[model samples]
Target: MTRRIRPRPRPKPHPHPLQLYSLRDICTIRILRFASSPELLEQYTNASGGLRTGMLMEHLDSLAGSIAYKYMLGPEVETLGRVQERGFYIVTASVERLDMLAPLYPVRDIRLSGQVICTGKSSMEVAVKMEALNPNRREETLMLGRFSMVCRNASTHKAHPVNLLIINTREEKVLFKMGESARNRRKYAALHSLSRVPPSSTEAAELHSTYLKYGQDDESLALGDRVWMGDTLLEKTMLMFPQERNIHQKVFGVYTYQLGFANSCLFTRSHVSFLSLDGIAFRQPVPIGSILRLRSQIIHTSPPGQLPAAVHVRVQASVVDVQTGQEEPTNDFRFTWTRDDGQTVPRIVVPRTYQEAMLWLEGQRALKMGTQIRGSRLQGRDR
Candidate 1:
């Protein structure tokens, strides 16, 4: 992919603090830790008196940016002036993984921390953890997320090299390996995505069996055993504003994530706990002032089981040009949620069209991979 490169002018005598340090220096200063007061949590709560997942996502994105900036810029040193004088911009490329281990309540104070765990030439992987604490109590981890960010020249929008991460401690080394594994998994999944190639023989056979089991005809639709593809789908449109743009003058990836996640939660309309978010791929950059159309659909639901049923939803965001009447995809998000009541509903999505079937199958693949990844992480932690 070719990126536009713009020429950057020489920095003036005074440069911003963001341009000062590398990841090494930034890690020492604890640049990615943020604390929110209980009052602040109260302000962010929804009508149901619970903290919204969208708000948490917004904070995670910001924390990821801070870590990326520090990794790219270096630590503040007055005597050394500025480590790198040229100002650069960083934007989220993708959110590889975000798992909500526990829900955050309004009574608890929130704390977030992020650090650069892996880096390429111009891209870095940031691991962000969110914790909640009650009055005079120890902190408990609520959620964890990983973000991939790319640095670019402020003017040209082309990729820029970032400082390499220095691994010293055994823990840091392990984290670095984890990040590398995540990156490799992402790459492999992308290369094997259904969008890139046709399904294998086994996958094709599975699809055929799925169609035979759940495919609805006119008579079946009337029986109410199946729901229309349009019935469970939800869509929202909003204009991207400058206030939500990042330093790169483009809409922040997290803003789109917040919109998609909130809409999915609303559509489910059940007391559901956030499980995981995966396959979040940013296809294109959303320009400021553009109209964004977000569409979400319940693609799959868990079978009848003793545990709470899991529902998988897919959200796609596209940029619409009002004058030209053209729309292009910007990002794709897949989220998994489990019913809080532990009620298993034998709900299966019936795709009315071939396009819908493709989407449904894609969601199935994503959910399987997400489950595997979560299981592997748990095993690692236990070890």
Candidate 2:
């Protein structure tokens, strides 16, 4: 794909305790000449003729990394250079969230942009945005997301400090604060994660209520229009290909994101509309040739509303050790989806096991947050 990069330059050096960078100094804008090239849009179009969100995610991941690397390696450098020679490499630590703002029309030219808005001792918060350009030169926001990236020393495999951001304007402070808040939230969420502690009392009570309603049926098991979470699983297994490899020669996280979106569609058997993706954590780097297993499940369902219901799904990406027969999980993806308004799902998702119950609660949390976010956006727009 041909790209038109927005011009940028760095007035600083090319070393460790890197120079202070303005937010604009690290910004990267890529124009996908879709309107000019009709032939290239076929691969990125979904079966329904809309832009494929999974493909957009791949671009976001790539753009975020490019912005991060530019921050560390300066704008004059076009390539990642040599990993070992450069001393450090960038990796996605986690994705805070990605929200669909407007419909992504397939025929429109899209612009992808990202910049390092905030930085820590070693980590950076890269904010990415997607906009669809119209014939009159108007742009509509299509998607917005934040990526947490960290640098690692190539030799020691330890956290490597990156170039600092020199926050100048009020807008820059707001962006920086958002990143700071996200980091704090991650720390808080990790502490309260199900792996480290039991469910809260309120969550336990909710799970008990679910058990009384769904688990009491001994014969049909699903006495009502609700199915066990275990029954809603869909899996995809594939070998990591060289084409999906990132700058570090590791399978890109975007592949996992795409797999999750595709698998979620199969779970519902519909052309699901995307709402949001949250709480993505990349635990391990998958080698280019590793075998990948993606397990997707419907973890939560909001009670039927005007739209019938909203499904909250989770996909776990794992790498299988061919020799030892071991499956080590590498990432977790949470997404929210629904069909067009007024359509209803056949059944609600219910958790029977304690483990699944915990996941149910986590998905519930994500759904609630996504709803609030969209609600606030709508409110702001209405004003």
Top of the candidates by lDDT: 2
Candidate 1: global Cα-lDDT? 0.70
Candidate 2 Cα errors over 4 Å, as ranges: 1-17, 218-224, 253-259, 266-269, 306-308, 381-383
Mark the 10 consecutive residues where model 2 has the least summed lDDT. 215-224
RMSD of each: 6.9, 9.1
Write model 1 residue lDDT over 1-383, tens digit each, in one string.
Answer: 99989999877652333333333455421212223455565557766777777667777877788777656555443222232345566778888879876666666556778788888888888888877755676766677778988887665778777776677878888888978987897898779877788877876787687677667365655655555556786778889888887655677645544554554455444667778886578888889999999888787666436354677788889999899989999888888877766666445566667677677777677667767767766665556
Model 1 — which ten-residue stretch has the worst lDDT?
27-36
Give me the candidate number with maximum TM-score.
2
Error of 2 at 114 (Å): 1.2
- TM-score per prediction, in order, is 0.81, 0.90
- In the range 299-318, model 2's lDDT, one tens digit per residue, is 98776453535778888889
* TM-score, candidate number 1: 0.81
